[model samples]
Target: MATLPYWRLSGFYLFYFALLGATAPFLALYFHHLGFSSARIGELVAIPMLMRCVAPNLWGWLADYTGQRLLIVRVGALCTLFSFALIFVSKSYAWLALVMALHAFFWHAVLPQFEVITFAHLREQPERYSQIRLWGSVGFILTVVILGRVFEGLSLDVYPVTLVVVMAAIVLCSLWVPNAQPSSGNRKVLADGFFKQLRSPGVLAFYACVALMQMSHGPYYTFLTLHLESLGYSRGMIGLLWALGVVAEVLMFMAMRRILLRFSVRRVLLFSFLTAGVRWLLLGSFAEHFWLLLLAQLMHAATFGSFHAAAMTFVQRSFGPGQQGQGQALYATLAGVGGAAGALYAGYAWNTLGPTITFSMASVAALAAAVIIATRLQEDRP
Candidate 1:
């Protein structure tokens, strides 16, 4: 039996998400510092997500064709580091947009391939994935909480420095973790072709719901910090609020084994969509109240934690061994498309319709996802 490189895998997730922790909460604020409008900020943030629509599938196919997933991850990590370094050269909107899109194209390629590698390592025990993935949440918490305080002392100008450090760490971790190919026997068990699996009603519904679920997160991902700041929340407090959500996610991941054993993936996903709708409604309606905001943040357990674990499981079970790369890639693609749409719409709506209506739109998107899951998603038997 091969030893699971638990810490290595965990370390990569830690640094990768630490990068996200630094960027997602503060990037909009950084754009605000540069005096960009909400629409432009939305476009800037949406660039990487738009890249996700195409980058993952392209890279995923190459990985599957070549069987060099880890190599792809390494090259991607390096490319992301170099591309993002260009941000320091120009602060122009066009330049920044191009850099973000370029960096994201490579950055987005890393995760889906890494996910396939991780699943390859886990082999038969897919449930243990949450255990390994929880480190990412811990990283998110640490970065958000610490950076929240750091940004309070410093300005958003320090944001790029923090991101660069985390990105470098990702490259180092990618180098440290060697690849593990699935056994030939496992690969031989490819029962369904990728396209055939994708053609299933359940598969189609699941992907649609996945897209909508992420779409619902657009405002939160793109502008939650700015929204809270407008409500008189300090940077540190906003970071804590962001950390609070991931803390809930970490706890949920810790308990995911029990959750999975008790509930069907379809059921968990349905509940996630419903909770997301409610969470968005509360966020839009009562963000000024600390308790309500905290309560809303707690919903991250359902919205992302359980939803993601369930979605991964659905993809794993739906696609055969040879198809894992494409399955994960497809998931990333739809998520990217949905996220881009969400960010674009949120950007347009934020200035004109304001935060309340913008978030209400997120709520409607979540509700729509719930309906799709409820009506069209079928439970696959173990």
Candidate 2:
């Protein structure tokens, strides 16, 4: 039996999501600080997401074919760092857009492959995944809380430097993590190919639901900080709000092993989608009410935490060991498609439809996902 390199795996997630902690909440604000319009900001922010649709598949294929997931992660991390360093060179809209595209191409390549590596490490003890993954939530919380304070006192100019530091940490952690191939003995060899498995019962619907769930997040990711700023909230408060969501996510992750044991992944996914619908509605309609906003943020536990763990389990079980890389990659790809579409539409709709309507649209997207899951996704034991 292999001893889980538990802390090392957890360390990689820490830095990997620390980079997200820096980017997800602040990157748009950074673009705003640069004087870009909402539409342009959406486009810039969506660039990486757009790259997610492409890069992950390419890198996933390479990893699966070569059995070199860790090397891909290291190369992706290094390239991400180098590409993002170009941000300091120019603030022009075109330059920033190009930089976003370049860095995100590499950045998107890291996670899905790393996810495969992480699970490969976990092997038989798949339930322990969230225990290790919760460290990522911890990383997100630390950065958001600290940087929230940091930005309050300093200029947003520090944002890029902060991201670069986190990216460097990711590179270091990638080098530290050991590679794990999916054990040949444990693999379920399917007679059908990757696409056939993808078309298997409930699989396609699940993927579509994944895309819709991400699509619903567009306004929250792209504009929630700006929205709060418009509502007279301080950057520190906004940071706390962002951290609040992940804090809930961390607690949820800690409980996920028991949760999964008690509930089917299908049930968990359905509940997640329904909770997301309500969460979006609250965010759209009641954001000015502090308690309501807090409740909405707390729903992140269901929306991302439980939903993600359940989704990973589903994907892992849906495909054979030979196809894990592509399975995870396709998951990322559809999510990218949905997220990119959401950002684009939110960018166009935000100024025209305003926050209430923009967020209501997000609510509708989430509910739509719920409906799909309730009706189309079948229960399966993992």
Candidate 3:
């Protein structure tokens, strides 16, 4: 712990997720303020996710082949900043869509490669990952709370500028992070071994569950703000609700080392999926009830915090050193596929089937993931 470049690695995650905090809850609202319909907002938001499908794989392969993950991270961050700045130039649907795709292409390239760098730095101390990662939740909480208040007092016009500032912070942090490499001796063997391992039944099942888990989040990420706002909650309150979820997540992260030490990763994942299923159902059915909505928000600890931590550990253990970049990239790719699908479906459903049915659909997706993990994913030590 004393020897690790802990602050550098943690700082990158802080700003990276801070960018997420700014966009995830507010981007759609900004689009709505521009008078776009639900369908258009969905399409615009999905554009970046669609880019995730292609960008991460391409960048990951390049990072693996060249062994310059940190260099790629820096370049990707700079490009993301420039591309996203184009949002200031236009409010046309086509223009915003293009900006989303362009910025996300580079933005998506940063994290998978950076994950490889962090793990390399951790080396033998992977369990400490959550301690470092918890700062990201803090960054998220700060942005969500502050911006929520800002938006309450100001216009949505400030949204783009706020994002640009966060992106700039990400660029600065990317430059500050030191590079690290995984083992190189088995490069050829590990490189060739990636596909072979990916083909195994357990790995295939796990990836499928990954897609489903993210797909289940579509309604929440794409419309929760709007949904709560319709119910008359203030922007300041909505932001706090979002922050509360991440606060639970931070607490979960603080306890994850102890939890992982006592339980299998498979168990943690199963629990996460189960809780997600329940959370979505509650949100769909009883969102008007403050206590129920609060309970659902708290379940974010299981849905994102535990699920992500366990999945990261699983990926790290499943792939070899040479395959780390590709492994993380593939994970991001699946998440992108699921998220895109979710946003598109939620957008169409939010108006047609209504919020209850739309959220129920999300619940079903989560339950299906729970089933997959229960019946298919084999038990593994954490």
Best by lDDT: 3
On TM-score, the candidate that comes out on top is 3
lDDT of 2 by residue, 292-372 (tens): 999999999999999999999999888888788889999999999999989998888988899999999999999999999
Q: Can you write out model 3's per-residue Cα lDDT over 224-314, one digit (the tens) per residue?
A: 9999999999999999999999999999999999999999999999999999989988988898999999999999999999999999999
lDDT of 1 by residue, 114-227 (tens): 988998999988899999999999999999999999988987787887888889999999999978875433343442478888898789988988889889999999989999
Candidates' lDDT values, in order? 0.91, 0.91, 0.92
lDDT of 3 at 224: 95
My TM-score estimates for the predictions, one after another, are 0.97, 0.97, 0.98
Question: Model 2 TM-score?
Answer: 0.97
Error of 1 at 232 (Å): 0.6
The per-candidate count of clashes, in order, stands at 0, 0, 0
Regions of model 3 farther than 4 Å from truth: 186-188
Q: What C-alpha root-mean-square deviation, in Å, does candidate 3 show against the real structure?
A: 1.1
TM-score of 3: 0.98
Cα deviation of 130, candidate 2, in Å: 0.4
Q: Give the TM-score of candidate 1.
A: 0.97
